[model samples]
Target chain A: MTLILDYEAGNLASVKRACKEVGLDAEFCADGDQLRHAERVIFPGVGAAGSAMRSLAHRGLDEALREVILRGVPVLGICLGLQVSLDHSEENDTPTLGLIPGRVRRFNLDRTDLKVPHMGWNEVVPCRPHPVLAGIDPGDEFYFVHAYYTDPKVADCVLARTEYEHSFASAVGYNSYIGTQFHPEKSGRVGLRLLANFAAWDGQC
Target chain B: MLSKRVIACLDVRDGRLAKSIKFVDTKDIGDPVEKARAYYLDGLDELVFYDITASSDRRSIMLDVVESVASQVFIPLSVGGGIRSVSDATDLRLAGAEKINVNSAAVQRPALIDECAAAIGNQNVVLSMDVRRVEPTQALPSGYEIVINGGRQPMQMDALAWALDGERRGAGELVVNSIDADGTKEGYEIALTALISSSVRIPVIASGGAGKPEHLHQVLTEGKADAALVASMVHYGEYRVSDLKEYLQRQGLKMRMSW
Candidate 1:
């Protein structure tokens, strides 16, 4: 039973649908107890960091998620979910859950042609061997729509890297927690395969 | 490098999939969900669903179809047609649409773009414009005029100016649908596409005349479009999304190879 933590951010339905398509029994677990006891938790979000943190804090799921991660339960974060796991964010100058040793900063592209928000599909280059990227090809494209990105303090935590105006961390994994800067739910077959890999993972580092 | 996208646009009227010839002589093709599934399997980069009559009919969008198609297709789904307010955008988002496109409504009230962006995020708000070419007038110095209400009404706004305004108003993406070349299948209005695509930093999707794979390559490269929206070419079964994508890939355009 995989629980999709619901904290008022959008993309919950799409994430649940992706999990189901991957043959994982998933449910929206707004209740903290369900989130804590689920086999795996997918912390998905798509919004501002300040408001997302507020919603999680409002529902008291912030500490609940920390407890679940500390218990060696496999967890995956998507987009803003990846940003919120960092130490701090430039968006609203908000402090995040700090589950991953990193800070989220907006893209500072020097090129005039490069667009902000960084919307669309780009290649995901795997940096290390991890179960979440077991079947995904090194240059397989994933759907991305973000203005901010994660800069993990520990270089080894970087799972994959992608280039836009400049190369940035697109996926990160540490301990039992893994997060993707792109929306795997909307990335077609490659995305579904990644979700399945996460579902079958045994929470190994 | 970011790949060029091939999007399948379904113009649905009521509950059935409808295709138009130059925005008229409409004919029902097939089920939208089934077509969406076929496109999804064929590895189309994205999908766009427009409730064709919702705006002209003056009603809300068909959420049932949006929900049904969204459940089956797992790619980035963008829904448009009758999105008038922030609430309409919210409803579509709840129904599993990744992006909501505003056309006539945004022209009526430009603030609707900002409101929807605030309600959702800027990335989820798409501004779709129906544009027609005309002589360069004082009001529309770009020679392209903005048409609304399913291309039945013309506005004083210029296509290039409206696109820039939309981006400033917080629209994350823009769909420049050429009313003159829509459904003609002759080729994309490259001049119109290049004009708007170069003027905006946001991603621009060139909609309207997509007859062959070569047309897509032309727009994506020469026209500088981020994505190409296909209608009659794919809707009539003249070409599969895979065939078009493969042809584009061969032309040195970066495309996601599903198979």
Candidate 2:
């Protein structure tokens, strides 16, 4: 069964509904034991990074998530979920789990035309072949709502990129862990397909 | 490039789909869930459901309808109407709404904006203003006034000022609904939309008076709106969402055409 970590900062209902729509038998679990035994874990989050990290640490989910990743369990992070997996985030000056080698930086667009939070749908262009993005088209649009994005220190970790002011890492996959800056749960059919791909993935890098 | 969005607005009254002419002459259309699913399948960008009677009835929002629609629809769903407090925002968020829009309540108590933004993220809290054009005055310098209670009462606050205040209080997006153009099928209130869109740095959705695809294109381009919200055009089957999107795409306005 797939486990959706209820870190108290995530949109648990929408993510759960999306998983159910894609025929993925997922349950919301805040327990560490469930995270360790789950076949796949979806670490979906929203809100501020500092508060989210504090909640994760409070629930001991921070270490449990790192342990799950070390065990080679397939994990997918969404929005702030992807950010907290990085080394540090400029939002609230918070330190993260460091599951992915990167720092989350705020979008410093030179142009005044671009809006902050980067709300709405934008195209996601794949950088390399990955199982998580198997059926997703090159110009497929996914829903994104974030001011900060993950900048993977290692280029190989970036599976896809999107442009909004500048090209930022929209999707990253390192080992068995994969994450997307956009909310696949709210991205309609394309997002469902991505989640379905994750459900069927074998947790291989 | 970020494509312009075409959002379908469904006004639900007591668990059924309803439409009004400038907030009067209410008429029943169809089921909310069915219409939402149809719009979703027809390749619409997003969906907004407003419980039209919730605020006037002095009760909580219809969570059952929201839950039903959210379960069936897989796109970004924003729920509005009767969201007065942070708890209401939390309830809607838990009911699977991606965003919570506050209208009259925010004007009554601006702190609700801060409170909801604190409870949920600012990105999920939307400030939906029902604006009407009026003569320019010192107090209403922009010539547009904020209306509440389904456009029955007009607040003395200027539309531009309220928009900026909403942004200051942490509203992620602003939906400018023109009461003058509402249900008229003439076109959007370009001046009002442009005024708020230009003043605020956050994305603005131009609502009211979307008769055709050209009107949407005009609002998105000339009116300087990030998105356009439609009601009568799609609700009455006058145009399909796919056809509208194709028209916008042909007009050189980038739109997501993925099925």
Candidate 3:
């Protein structure tokens, strides 16, 4: 059973709906015990990193999440979920759950054309193959509404790279844990396909 | 490269999908949920739901409608109309809307943008403005004046200045709706859109007046808008979302065509 981590940061309904559409039975998991017992965990969020980390710490789900990843359980992080999995975030100057050795940095492009929040559909270019990104083709766009992006210390952890003003780690993975900066739940058909792939992903590659 | 977005605007009046000509003489067309589902199936990039009558009655948005539409549509859903507080924005977000657009209420209380930004991040807060073309004056120098109450009331505020103010107040994006070209299907107000798009660093969605794919292309390129919002063009079946996308693609504009 897949449990979606609910830390009370933003909406979980669309993520839940997307999981259902992909034939995956997912429920909100706020307690640490349920999170540890889940076969796979989907960590999704869409708000500030500071408050999100506070909520996770408040619920004691933070330590449980680190344990789940260490236990080799498949964990998928989306947007803020992915950002907070890093060591620290420039957003609100908050420290995150050090699942991956990296930092989340905000976009400070000098170009006027490349706007902050980088909102809208952009292509996700796969840097290497991974089970969760199976059906995602080259130039297949995903919905992204974020200002900050993950910068993993290990280059091999980056599964895919996307460009706005420059190349950034759009998808990163470590062992059984995977993270995507784009929202698969909101990417339409291509997004649903990614979710379907995640449902069947064994966290092997 | 990021693809230019093609968003379908659904104006809901009293729970029914409706179309308006310059914000008046609205005709109920079909069910919003069904329409949203159909558009989603047709490879639409995003969707915007405007609760047309919510402001007048001081009623909240139709969450049931948003919920039903969001259940089926996997694309990003942005909802506006009668969102006066963070609670209202939170309700829509809980109902599966990724973004909440605030127009009239935000104009009335400029701090609403700041409050919503604090509550639900700035990226999800879209500042929607309904503007009318006016002669350039000392106070309203952009020649575009911000109008509220579904274009019935003028706020005497300059549109360009308001755009900057909204961005400063933590709005991530702006939906520049032109009352002059809305539902007319002639074309978008290129000058108006270009002015705001050039002035702000945030993404600008040029709303109102899209008859064909060419108009969309024009607004995206010439008007310098990041996205184009259409209503009557797709709502009345004049053109499908695919037709518009294909046309734009052929015209050398990158679009998400994975469907």
Candidate 4:
């Protein structure tokens, strides 16, 4: 069973349904006990980083989430969940778990022509070989909705990236903790393939 | 980069597909699933089913119709009308809808955006505003008031300000429909749309007044909307999706046509 960390961050029903649609059972876990017993864990986030950071702090789920990912449990962070995995986010001016070495920065745009909160479906191209993205192709479209991205120094940490106003890291892999800026559940077939790969892969970190 | 979107808006009443001319003359447009699938194959990018029936004891969104369409189509589906609470949002999701659009109900309680955004991801919650250039009236900016209950009542709000506020309140995207131009096929209100688009941090969908392929191109290029939603033109077969996409490409707009 995959434990979905729930701190009122993002309980994407479709994400849960997508897992079930693929025949994997996931439980929304907001407590440490549930995380301790689960085989794997997922950090799903939607909404603003400021509000999300507040929600995580308010529920005290921030430390609980950090503990689980630090224990080397295969954990996946989606969107804002990925943002919170960093050291600091410009969004909420809040500090992240620092599980991954990076800072979340706003999209760098020279012109006001491009929209912020870069919403909608965009493509993802993986730069490194990893089990979760075993069969995915380059330039595969994935659903993305965010205003910030990570600037990590560790080259090995970058797994996938996509271009908008500029190219930025879309997915980062470190140890067993994986963070995806896109919602794999809503990303159609390619997304499901990535999730299925995650579900089947043995702890490799 | 995002491609131009062609939306098949299903107006349902009393649990069936309902379409009307100018919000009056009504008809059943066959099975919504078949209609939507035909559009999907025709290269439509998105689907929006407006619950025109919910307000009038005369209409209600057919959840059954939505479920049928959802099972057959994988594209993003947005359902609006009579969505008042988080339960309503969940009910639509359980019915297989990818997004729940709240209009009148959300303005009544801004926190409803939070309620829905918290339960379901904010991306799944769309806040659609029915805006019109009301006669320059009392203590308001530009006389652009938010219309609710199917444009039957006016709320004291500015369309431009609401766009930014909606995003701040946690709406994934804003669908700004120009009530004055809806179904007119005249063209989009570029000035109004651009004002709202530049004001907001999220992508804005331009709705109403799409008459020709040029209109789509104009709004997308000149108006600078991330996407344009066409309903009547596609529904009545005024123009084919193939023709529209080709026209957009010729005009130098980037769009992916998946067959």
TM-scores, all candidates, are 0.97, 0.98, 0.97, 0.80
Full-model lDDT for every candidate: 0.90, 0.91, 0.91, 0.77
Q: Which stretches of candidate 2 lie over 4 Å from their true place?
A: B54-61
* Chain B alone vs. reference chain B, TM-score for every model: 0.96, 0.97, 0.97, 0.92
Off by over 4 Å in 4: A48-73, A203-205, B2-4, B33-45, B55-76, B85-99, B105-125, B131-148, B152-172, B184-186, B198-201, B233-247, B256-259
Candidate that scores best on TM-score = 2
Q: Order of candidates by lDDT, top first?
A: 3, 2, 1, 4
The worst-scoring run of ten residues by lDDT in candidate 3 chain B lies at B53-62
Better of 1 and 4 by TM-score: 1
The alpha-carbon lDDT assigned to residue B254 of candidate 1 equals 88
Candidates 3 and 4 compared by DockQ, better number: 3
Candidate 2 clash pair list: none
Q: Compose the digit string of candidate 3's lDDT tens values, residues B1-259.
A: 7899999999998889999898888999999999999988998999999998744543444888889888999998999988889999998898889899999999999999999998988888999999999999999999999999999999999999999999999998999999999988899999999999999989999998899788999999999999999998898898999999989999999999886
Winner by lDDT between candidate 3 and candidate 1 = 3
| Residue A37 C-alpha lDDT in model 4 | 70
Instruction: Report the TM-score of candidate 4, chain A only.
Output: 0.93
- DockQ, all models: 0.69, 0.80, 0.83, 0.23
Cα lDDT, model 1, residue A47: 91
Q: Residue by residue across B183-236, what tens digits does model 4's lDDT show? A: 678998887788888777677789888888888888887777888887778777
**Candidate 1 lDDT score at position A188:** 88
